[model samples]
Target: MKIKRRAMLESTGLNMTPMIDVVFQLIVFLMLATDFTNTEIERVYLPKADAAQADDHPDKTRLMANIIHRISTESDCPQLKYKNGVLLQPCQIENHWKIVVRGEEIKTQERLEELLTIEGNLDREVPGNPKTPSNKPVMIRADGSAPFHLITRVLEAAGKALVWKLEIGAEKPPE
Candidate 1:
């Protein structure tokens, strides 16, 4: 007796439906998880002046202060500390910087004074050589939403403290 053979067929195409689904899911997840709150700060409209490029190089003993608008039940405007470009946690700077206001309102004037005091204290403690003006440069990284008035006040206070160099940390505007 002769046996008959059956031919089998094989599929050459790959199933990409599952892979595409996984990729789309990952994209959606990342988009939802990313935080974009700070993007507005980079879009601040800074006043234009004929002023030359200010020295941005931090002094050997540079002091950085990060000013941001914080929300609280008592005060909404609080001057927070920025150390080495990082925002410090609450009550982090026990001796260096302190919040002087309470309440939800922003106290632009008082914040300036407090910042100036901190600069003065730092200058006195960390003496710079005569070659470097104000041995300790005061750098301010204000939140994008913070009013220009607040920044101006801080600059004024810095001037009073004999701080010739004032650097504002900002991102380059998009082209």
Candidate 2:
């Protein structure tokens, strides 16, 4: 008995409409899920400065310290506290201040020390020559209405942490 075999059939072109639809859906989902706000620091009307400059190169690595007012709680709001030491719980009263380092509040001077020490020890050495890392610019974003004492405390804490280079975030006045 002889078996008959048919030749391979020519295939139609692929349809990219479904794939494009999926891609678009994924893009929309990601855009919605990802937050564009700078969550590291809360929104505040920054004080105006004549010499205030936008950070031209925003990709540089640096530690951000935020001095923000206390959260106001209304009718048992949710809160977040994790191993990273971040606290997002509502405060008993508004206008309370906090010093946060790497998403965690600065409870003590030692926490700041630990953060700096870890950053310094992270892949920054040149082979066998372990030298003091150049001062990492510590950016401080404080509310314009934030008390002057709070700013001073943050500065003093930064000094204690041995971070010399500092950048204070401010808004430019309207022309």
Candidate 3:
């Protein structure tokens, strides 16, 4: 007896619509998350610390003030490091530096203090108590070659604002 040949199976393609949607969703989520976190930080070359501790648990409500030196002219001896694609150089001139907070450049010390004061006024630990300082933490991220006086000015501003919780940013020395 002659056996009948089996019918050939039809090839099916993958339903990629759902997969593509999922991938796009993930991309959007990651972009949003990255923007929120990075908006608060400014890239600056930090000083090397012998005993620097990693910020494993960063507070979400923490405030950051970044001291950036606007590199004007090429230096004879550059810092030889790059942070956020900007070349780090030794800038001793006070005018070449500026303070940035929450993506806004603080042009004057008065303006810096004013902004910090507003920040300090919110979320008081002891409600309705004027003496109670703000619970929010503030951090100063200064470039390695930044002038000490500028950092001091930031400290004075924080003190004036009554935000006591403060931190200085530093990086571990290269091994």
Residue 6 displacement in candidate 2 (angstroms): 43
Model number with the top TM-score: 3
Query: Candidate 1: worst 10 consecutive residues by lDDT?
Result: 96-105
Rank by lDDT, descending? Answer: 3, 2, 1
| Model 2: colliding residue pairs | 70-96
Clashes of 3: 0
RMSD of 3: 5.9
Candidate 3: which stretches are off by over 4 Å? 1-36, 71-89, 129-131
Sliding window of 10 residues with minimal summed lDDT for model 3: 76-85
lDDT of 1 by residue, 1-175 (tens): 6554442345567999999999999999999999664332222223333443554553544555555444444742244544554445333222222222222223456665555555566555346432223535566665544446556766776666667667776655334
What residue pairs are clashing in model 1?
41-144, 66-82, 74-103, 74-104, 75-103, 75-104, 76-104
Candidate 3 global lDDT:
0.79
Give candidate 2's whole-model lDDT.
0.63
Error of 3 at 37 (Å): 2.2
Q: Say which candidate scores most in lDDT.
A: 3
TM-score of 2: 0.57
**How accurate locally, in lDDT, is each candidate?**
0.51, 0.63, 0.79
